[model samples]
Target: MNTLPIRPEIPWLAPLAGYSDLPFRMLCRAHGAGVTNTEMVSAKGLCYFNRGTSSLLNTHPEDAPLVVQLFGADPDSYHQAMDKTLEMGFRFFDLNAGCPVRKVTKSGSGSRLLENPDRLYAIAEIMVNKAGPGAVGVKTRLGWEKGVDTFLDVAKRLEDIGVAWLTLHPRYGKQLFSGQADWSRLAEVKQAVSIPIVGSGDLYTAEAGVRCLRETGIDAVMFARGAMFDPAIFERFHALMRGEESPPRDGEHLARIVRMHIQYTREFDGSDRSFRKLRSFIPRYAKGLRDIRSLRNELISCETWEALESAASRIREMQPADPLGFDPADVIPD
Candidate 1:
């Protein structure tokens, strides 16, 4: 019999596209995240030796317990990618079935696999068998549509096939983050499967994360958008669990991390590319500040690191809307 791996019960950073790259993962790790998964990588791309996709496998010495997530429907591609990933020194891997992006779903990958449990199971079995028992896991949504209990069967099937663990986002594919995530289904799915079940979806506050684990009895909690808003959330979660009050989300602290993020990104990917990439996240870092949208638009239009630094200097001089208590609800559009 294959032994089950010990599931990480602490708060983790969920794999987020364009956001959970190496520098961001390092920042979350420095805060308190026990594990950080890579953005969903394409197994087909790995099989075909795509250079851009292969670049996503980059890792740092500090990024231990990293989970590389792969998304694809081909078993052959999975096997090939597993070999390559192992060769690249990755010990933990996850199959992603929770992504709701149209390109991925239309390609018969991602959440589309939820429509056929057998194929999902087959692909997972192949991955686990090649990666060895307890080395491979899965992340998936509840089902293709709302009011469907398809995840119960999917979770059970994955458990029986010896998947290492399950990270469940309690939202249907059709919903695509439209409505509230039905966390009630998480409780039911956890009870249906023997494997560890980690809960995701709408976990913005430390209290919300604590509730998900306490109320639903999940093995752990994974933060997605929450981490984007504040990488220090991992630290906040730990403090809350220790019976301490939540930490302050002041402008000084936010500005410091934003600068640190910029520095780290520049070091990792160089100045120009990092500045371009940081555009998407500038608005997020500028939350709760006065005239942030306009500032964000200006920063997004900046062509060089010098211009970004100048813009950031202006932001530091201004006072935040609520200096001590930054609201998590004030999200800027992508």
Candidate 2:
């Protein structure tokens, strides 16, 4: 029998609202992302048939093995929305129990669910039943507040309730993005659960990706802001895993991805909104490029695709200041 590779099993692209749109997803896939997730959508919004929510669920032929993430406090609405998701041909569904935004938690969603494991189990059970076997999963943080650890119990419950997988960010809600992620805790959860455990947070480099997988013994790894800064990270990590030297970052290729992303966003969500969304990724794409601050400022101010394309072309002409150490400062916190 041929044994499959276990460590660094899958290169995952995490869902960032407005950032992980189809264009960026396709770019990541082209480069080497193994699995990609959609941005978190409101279960209530989907149940209510909101146009914006519906558009977020849209996927192209190339966007296969996609996971659609849903956020809501009510189990009934979650069930209804997941039913609709399945009707729309999505096989994988993830429940968002980890978002720490004030607006989300205030509504009893996101990280707030960690406060009540029973409720979390109830919701996961309903989604699992609705999604049938091997269709449901959960993504969550370590706990709700500082110094509180609930991931071990949460992971076990999710496994017992038939969750196919679990993605742990390994940070408490109170910590937000500050401080380092507790990788040891992730290791603990990995040992506690039978389901596939995906360890997330602070995996910004290929070295860190390898370190996290080796240290935590996770089934796979998930990339959020790190992927935004370097879309080639997955490919680079894959090369490193195979005992090959990491490839050099190509500024021209990065610029081309930016252009393609802008076009795809425009095609997917017409009007200036798509352009506006594309602006969020500029800082990442332009990281380490000379005078990118000025270039990004100019690009963000452009109101049309033509203008955006012009600015991008100008950015492409300039060489990156530091080829290897250019980390984008505008990473979205998990």
Best by TM-score: 2
| Model 1 CA lDDT for position 70 | 94
Tens digit of per-residue lDDT, candidate 2, span 17-49: 767778778878877888888989999999888
- lDDT, candidate 1, 102-142, per-residue tens: 87888778888898778899899988888887788888998
For candidate 1, give the lDDT of residue 95.
91
lDDT of each: 0.80, 0.80
Kindly report the root-mean-square deviation of model 1 from the true structure over all alpha carbons: 2.9
| Candidate 1: regions farther than 4 A off | 1-9, 322-334
RMSD to the true structure for each prediction, in A, is 2.9, 2.8
Worst 10-residue lDDT window, candidate 1:
325-334
